[model samples]
Target chain A: EDQVTQSPEALRLQEGESSSLNCSYTVSGLRGLFWYRQDPGKGPEFLFTLYSAGEEKEKERLKATLTKKESFLHITAPKPEDSATYLCAVQGMGKTSYDKVIFGPGTSLSVIP
Target chain B: GAGVSQSPSNKVTEKGKDVELRCDPISGHTALYWYRQSLGQGLEFLIYFQGNSAPDKSGLPSDRFSAERTGGSVSTLTIQRTQQEDSAVYLCASSQRGVRGSNQPQHFGDGTRLSIL
Candidate 1:
């Protein structure tokens, strides 16, 4: 079975504290690993897509890195505005373009000012 | 260009009543997906439509749930005999699924919040 699990389900950090969230997966074949940030009452916003191990992508204060079995989303000196639920998903191997990717329960982050 | 859009930002219905939710994918996206998000369940994949075919309906919880795509652009998800358990956020996402192995980022909509009384 294809599954994605995120650790430290919830975290609290000071305004300038830096931390990382983890997402581990087991899939028959991995096409891509996706990172998303979701705010309350809103849908997820695309963050990064890591296609292979050792791949990394960064945007703003967030950096995403991927390995064969896991992915990490690192937040650098986050602010209150950066507080949101970070989700990780994996696209499995298949020809059906609409094959739904599996999502983790998400890691909720709270930044204290 | 506008991203994926959904109708009836919120819906309140009684049990046993049928309800329909709609999704308008990005203009040129050929792949669409529907998912349900609950308090602790995360996001549950309900259905997927590539072009006009649904190769997978395995994620749907019951036979009362069904979906269809018309003209390969607009899609509708219908749930009959709604139950209290059906109350959740129905999210629609569109993606350029044709790109193989990469570049298939799913763009989500605000989602329709369904409340079954």
Candidate 2:
């Protein structure tokens, strides 16, 4: 079974603090790794997509890096507005020739101003 | 719509009732997806539709769950005999296409929060 695991279930950071969230996965064939930010009662917003190991993508204060077995979402100088649940998902090539994505339990990030 | 749009922002009903949630993907998106987000749980993939290809329903938890995408634009997810465990935020997402290596990011909507009584 393809599985994704995220570490540090919850994080509280002071404004401008920097940290990284982790997402580990096991899949047959990796197609893509996605990062999203979801606010309470709202749907997730797409952030980045990492396709291969040693690949990295960034958007404003967020940076996403991927390895063969895991991915990291690094938040740099985060602000209150950046407080949200960060989600990690991996799309893999299935045995049936179809593609399915498996998600990790998100890391709730709270940036206290 | 400019982005993915889902109907019925919130719904509350008895356990035995049936419900239908709808989603309208972006104007030209060729791939649509449905997922369930339970409290404290990660997003669970439920179904996926890509262009005219057959939908992959392998992620659906049970036979009571079904979905359809018509005209390659709008999609609907139906649940029969809704159980208390079914109460969660039903999310819909869309992308430019659904092929491997396309690298299209899925855009989501403010999901429909379902509450079972």
Candidate 3:
């Protein structure tokens, strides 16, 4: 069975603090791994997509790295505006055999000023 | 340009009543998807439509849930005999293509919040 799990369900970080959120997955024929940021009362916004192991992508203060079995979202000097629920999803290759992207139970991060 | 859009930002209905949720995909997008997000839960895939191909409804939890994409542009998800457990945020997303290797990312809408009484 393909599954995605995110650790540290909730995290409270002081402003300018750096931390990392984890997303582990078990799937067959991985196609892509996606990261999204969702704010309260709004839909999720796309962040980055890592297509292969050892791949990394960055935007401003956020950086995402991928591995064979897991992915990490590293926040550097996060500000209060960065506070939101980070979602991790993996898209597999098979639809007739499996569902589409499997999402992880997001990690809520609160950057207190 | 506008992104994906859903109707009725919020809805409150009594149990046993039927409800229909609508989704309008982005212009020119060939793939549309529906998902349910409950409190503290990840997005659950409900249904998917790609171009003129058959929709994949394997993720629907019950037989009461059905969806249709008309003209390959707008889609509707209907729930028959709504139950309390059916209350959740219904989200719609659209992608440019459906090919697995295309790596097309899905853009989401604000979603419709449903509350069953």
Q: Using Cα atoms with residue i matched to residue i, what is each candidate's TM-score against the true structure?
A: 0.95, 0.95, 0.96
- In candidate 3, stretches whose alpha carbon ends up further than 4 angstroms from where it belongs are A95-99, B98-100
Model 1 agreement with the true structure over A25-107: per-residue lDDT tens digits: 99878988999999999999999999999999999999999999999999999999999999999988755532669999999
- Candidate 1: regions farther than 4 A off: A94-98, B101-103
Identify the runs in model 2 with alpha carbons over 4 angstroms from their true place.
Answer: B98-100
lDDT of 1 at B38: 92
| All candidates: DockQ | 0.71, 0.75, 0.63
Winning candidate number (TM-score): 3
> Candidate 2's residue-wise lDDT over A5-91, tens digit each?
998999999999899999999988898899989999889998999999999998999999999999999999999999999999888
Number of the predicted model whose DockQ against the real structure is largest: 2
Better of 2 and 3 by TM-score: 3
| Number of clashing pairs per prediction, in order | 0, 0, 0
lDDT of 3 by residue, B6-88 (tens): 98899999999999999998999888889999987889989988889888888999999999999989999999999999999
Native contacts retained, all candidates in order: 0.83, 0.81, 0.53
Model 3 error, position B14 (Å): 0.9
Order by lDDT, highest first: 2, 3, 1
Worst 10 residues of 3 chain B by lDDT: B96-105
